[model samples]
Target: MAEKGDFKHEHMADEANDNDTVDFSNNISARIKNPLAGIRQDVLLRDVEEFAAMYDLSDITPLLKKGALVAQNPADFENVEGLDDTERDVLRDEVVHKWRQPRALYTTVILCSVGAAVQGWDQTGSNGANLSFPVAFGIGDTDPTSPNYTRDLWLVGLINAAPYIASAFIGCWLSDPLNNYFGRRGTIFFSAIFCLLSVIGSACTQNWWELFICRLLLGIGMGSKASTVPIYAAENVPALIRGGLVMSWQMWTAFGIFLGTCANLAVYNTGAISWRLQLGSAFIPAVPLVIGIYFCPESPRWLMKKGRYSQAYKSLLRLRNHPIQAARDLYYVHAQLLIEHKIIGQTNYAQRILELFTIPRVRRATLASFTVMIAQQMCGINIIAFYSSSVFQQAGATVLHSLLASFGFGLVNFVFAFPAVWTIDTFGRRALLLFTFPNMAWTLLAAGLCFLIPKDSSAHLACVALFIYMFAAFYSPGEGPVPFTYSAEVFPLSHREVGMAWAVATCLFWASVLSITWPRMVAAMTPTGAFGFYCALNLIAFTMIFFWVPETKQRTLEELDYVFAVPTGKHMKYHMTKSAPFFFKRYIAMNKNATLEPLYRFDNVQSDAVRSASVTAYNQEHRKSETTKKLNL
Candidate 1:
């Protein structure tokens, strides 16, 4: 009714108002939006009432209301009415002192740690047995002149690769169903049984094929347990300390490797039965895992997914310090789940697996998960983890000295992993990967080049061991802790089990390839060539990570949905254009005043309608600018 330009300007101003509500521009600092942020008080109360009624929680409805309010705005817990001093103090501790968690939570972490140790022990068991078993089975091929050398090398590699073959092809794939039916604790217990029986069977096998079969059986346990334990730990811990707590999987796994080396050294002199004991001693870690898993509470998110809200509330009680904290987490997670269900929709197991590639949000997480998991293998840690003894022997050490050096490598691996507990959440996951990969690459190359030194020279073995130890030192704090922790936390809960299975399978598959080919590779390429090959791979892994992996420190599992929702192209462009230049200016050019703008805006308390309107307004403003420029031209 007004002049045409005036009407147009009025419409644009409305759109601009909408844009202001949900600024999706690159200038905004990224944050995880609170799921319950913008709901009306009455609406939230009604939802809580319905939730309590459905879950038989009306007995605690008043508590539930208080919990819901706190969950909606955790920062204002001090202002939450009806909260006592003790409850307020506990909430304060969660922020001011995050490490002061319930003892039950630590106990659960310990159990998962034992499960990880079993995995590490299984690997080194085969490692130590490698020196003796091939000869015992009539396939020793150390000499190049032997007519059966090639065949024996291939066979030895196959035996060494047996568990990973089974893991990659069979075990990892079974996690979803096992988790769906048996629950986390039950799945771990089942895997522990398999690990225990297989280690004992491996020790008793009379021939190569028998031992191979036992190790293959062991893979089933390794794959499933590896897939489940990190997820178990991630789900149980608070988001603030999730990385440090979950990384205990890698930390204790290193401990297990050290313990396995000790066992290998202890039984080195046992007449004719040394390899047998080395293989069987791995069962020790499995025993505790089999028994202790039941003592840990099942994951509350998983329980919530199954619609066992009452049970989830109970489980949360064990993990958190106070009843209010448990209720708040349970309610918040439930609210997030409601949004997740609306976004992801219901799908069958196969559909969920397909969604790993099909859904845009989920597929980003899949790519990121794959990047980190495969990077773990590409960084070449397992080559040393699986064959340090053989590598040391090749460096001209006597058998005992080789074993001792492998023990030293194990010690360095375990000792250096401690720093990641503090750094992973602070320096962050992506930063750790970027920093360590280059260091690992150079150190690994140096270790391999040391092989060129004259074997008669005393410095040859020392030089190789020194570089290898340095590589482990770099590896332990970064790639060692990040892969499992990142993979476990990245996916939405709807697809968590299958997503973790996919990630673990990718890791074990490549691990199998490395194990099966290294003996042949080392024989053909020499130590220098093989190490150099993986050294180049470390650089390639670093590049892939720089572009593909997103930083995911201190983000809750539910909140990660928004993080991954950023398209891969946008994420890649931001790093390539923005992050890369910032790094160059700040570090290379030594710029004192360089400031890198954040790529994503945080809409923590914004409603969907507000965000949508904000986008509309931003687009309208962009169009108006373009029109103005066109007119001027």
Candidate 2:
């Protein structure tokens, strides 16, 4: 009764429906497919109307309708009706002049920078203090022959590692509850209090144990602040330049490292109390962070999550340049959140933690975040960050010269980080990691080998410092910026705080391990062996990163759910089959025309239907070819 053509059309439509069902079942494939795509205009309008009514935004219902349309398909915003020229120009400026943001946004980023400075200064205060604190506390053991020598080494390491141990085990985990109840600004304020008190307490401590206890308390602040600041920056920033902005965390951390070294040098002349001054001076950064956090707006995403949509709108209004831009982002983020909630579902705290591993999409993000965070520790930057003065002393420099050399390393680190702000968004996260890791590997190896130079030779310290500075130079632009920025953006809103806690925990745990072990490791293996071990680790980190971590640059925090939804095995196989060969041919083999297809498809609403039709047609053609081959055979 049905004609052949009609039968074929029905069959194709049936196949498309089957495909859609399969995609929906996995949730992964459906997530990768844009939620905005193929959404009917009438349905979107109706949803917008309902959303406005539910949220008590009836006064802006007309604006909300237009905003929803623009949010659904941002690429077509220019053609979106009802947008005045001012609204249109603001959207255009978002793309063309990405950095031209509201002063409040820049202020928020700067405040976050100050928070990072507290973290860095906190870290390196112990670095300068490492020189004198052990002596003051009666734990100094420069003599290898002393009975207490081994015990002192462990004690000093334990003291240095105390903060990180606390951060990894206790402080990072607190971020979830702190952020949940206090909000970003509130959590940051709370952390700054701990940082302020701990630094002053460390300065006033009469003994090593007292100092250790103070540093342990410092970790509470460090972990929570570190976890929140990058997420705050990421949520506030536009995705087009998100990487550049969020990475300010590391850049300013580097600046704080530089300042710490300056404080070390500045107080070198202050007798008896110089180390105390060195440790307490870190409190200065915390002071600004505590006072200035109140000046910044709370993260709008966090506000939205609390069911305070009106407050979120008000917050976004301050962060974005114009009301329409604010409205668009608010509605867009809300739409994405609706879809995200449906897919992720609701869960208790424990269940959310479990879902991080149980959910396919979230599992990929967890693995990636773990990779980057651990890789940061594996790169061995913190070894230099925590003990560069001591390292310089071991390299045959005088105490003053060692402090100066440490200052040089700090200066190089801070200066080199400037490039990443420009490169991170444009050149991309994964590519920077790939490019810098090998360079870091060799430079670190070279620095380690430089330690083998005879102490009497003029070139010994020079070569050591040169290679160490070079290692820092390579590290500052790549690994330094990528970890926090990458980890901050990967998780969905539901898991963001916990996911970041997990990530920061991994980082600090390894940092604790490194700090605790490096003293003994260097004592047993010597500097060459110690540095060589981390150099090998750098390569290992590189391999893990190439296979596991996805490029997150330029994607919205909401959009990244789709990116991570891609199954891990398939992503790795594509890299092996396609990206590897293309890299080999294009860069290594010097081929000009080698092409590699992208792994993820970024399609707008119309392309979703087009892609479905194309897939169906292709399947039909492939079946015909197969049948002809079978008949011919």
Candidate 3:
């Protein structure tokens, strides 16, 4: 019986092998006559070849046994360069044309924008609460005879900072792994529950400790919001416009800041109920995130990594408007993951945190993350957001005048963020950061100098307001957006969430330190000196971005991994040039010699540099022909 069973299995295997050979032969012959047919045919087969070549999978039996046809011996990885400029432009145009159909990309931008709106609400809730809490609680100088006025101030700062301390670090840590296990919707749903609880807890607190606990829990919700929402936004948008759309999230954040600041003034007019009302207003937007995230799609990239191919295909279709071949898009996402999994295996929390420094590209990325986060916090963005009114009053503006000016500051923040959002894709990440740093540094220096002017002088106060506007205008576009965008994009898929969590944690960590320190700094050194210190920090940030920051704009997440994952000099030489001169020079010469050589096509392995260049050029030539055909000129 055993012998007969073995004979039967062998016979079946032979039959299957025969069938596969016939099909593959038919596909090759069919594609030989049809270039467009070959364009889509055997894409996965190409990927397998590319993967085998790039990763040296000839020795790996399972990959071979799993139906991948072996090709030439794998090439040295260093020998692989990106597609030359001509090819890149062609492929880029092809991708753009594909992305322009029914506007699934636009829908993705909108859904992710909604999530950002929630983030705005979360950050701004405390902004208003910061101001009115003291007034509403009736903690005052009359009590200085009983308790030091300074102590009350310290307590206010503590209470104000408590949520960021409690929430920021922990939420960032949890966002990615949870998203992996539960999907984007599930993580967002859980986060919204935290938001709801915090909101209810905020409205019902009976004493300072109760309020503190409530704020602490609210911080947890806010932390979740801070970490997960931006990830969703980045993952949803197409890479071409990713910077612009993702930066829009920060724009909404600024809008929220502005709204919250304005709300403080509106609610302050409510007499005894001011702070309670201010704290509770956050619930309005918080309700929508809980309800809305349910309707949002899971990140298609995340779905592909888990081999949930059908779901990934559908999600990609939804995001790209069901382009000519939606499933074809997964090839790129999957190929990138295969390379990433080579380094990180899969998402393990402890392993990821460690790998952030261990992997060379990841280490550069982690540094980028840390620098951007540090720059943002040290730039005094929070001071503007949380305590602008206070700064204005200390600089000798009337309370009414200062609060009103803060409202205008919020408006300017939103207005200026539009240009940042618009230009992030066009100007690129490095350009925006490079351009904004000088303006921000100079503005801070000028604002600090405003403090040197006589307190009673109206002209000095006018200069102070100009400084405020300058600070918001410069910051809203660049420093504010770069940190969030860079942290989310730089890490590979396997470790992105964890990396982001740690990055956000760093920001929160420093933010807590700064938030706690700012009041004391102001108490000790006055507003001018404090602003001067921030000016100096901006100078440091300027140098960091100039020297170390790579432009992530217009690059796919996979391309980013390719760029920074290698040693610095090597990565830059290939990635920095828009048109890789080496590839173009090599290919121009190689094409003359190898015109008769079979063109290589592998799906899993990236196209060989020359062949990839040809494919890119082929697409571009086709586009030019198509455009000419369209115009009938």
Measured by TM-score, the strongest candidate is: 2
Model 3 TM-score (2 dp): 0.76
Worst 10 residues of 1 by lDDT: 1-10
Error (Å) of candidate 2 at residue 232 is 1.1
Clashing pairs in 2: none
**Per-residue lDDT of 1-633 in model 1, one digit per residue for the tens?**
211011111222232233343222121234456767776677777777877886778887888888988877765666778999888777766755678899999999877778788778767877888899999999997789989999998898888888888988889889999999999998889888999999999999999999999999999999999899999999999987899999999998999999989998999999688999999999898887887887888999888887787888899999999999888888888776765665576788899889999887789889999999999999999999899999999999988999899999989999999999999988999999999999999999999999999999999999999999999999999999999999999998888999999999999899989988999999999999999999999999999999999888877787687788777777889999999999999999999899999865554422232334345446767999999999999
Please report, in order, the local distance difference test score of every candidate based on alpha carbons.
0.85, 0.84, 0.63
lDDT of 2 by residue, 1-633 (tens): 211111111222232233333232243343444455466678667777767776667788888888777766766776778999888777666665678899999889987778788678767778988899899989998899999999998999999889889989988889988998899999889888999999899999998889999999999989998888899999999887889989999988998999999999999989889999999999988888888898999898888777677778889999998888778778777766665665676677789889889888889999999999999999999999999988999999998999999999999999999999999998999999999999999999999999999999999999999999999999999999999999999999989999999999999999999998888899999999999999999999999999999888777787787788788887788788999999999999999999988787675532332334345446767999999999999
Taking all chains together, each candidate's TM-score versus the true structure is 0.91, 0.91, 0.76
Q: Give the runs in model 2 whose Cα sits over 4 Å from its true position.
A: 1-32, 605-633
Compare the candidates by lDDT and give the number of the best one: 1
Model 2 per-residue lDDT at 535: 97
Error of 1 at 52 (Å): 0.7
Clashing pairs in 1: 15-617, 18-613, 18-614, 19-614
TM-score of 2: 0.91
On TM-score, the stronger of 1 and 2 is 2
lDDT of 3 by residue, 209-307 (tens): 677777777667666666766777788776666787777668767777777667767876776666676676666655666776666668877776565
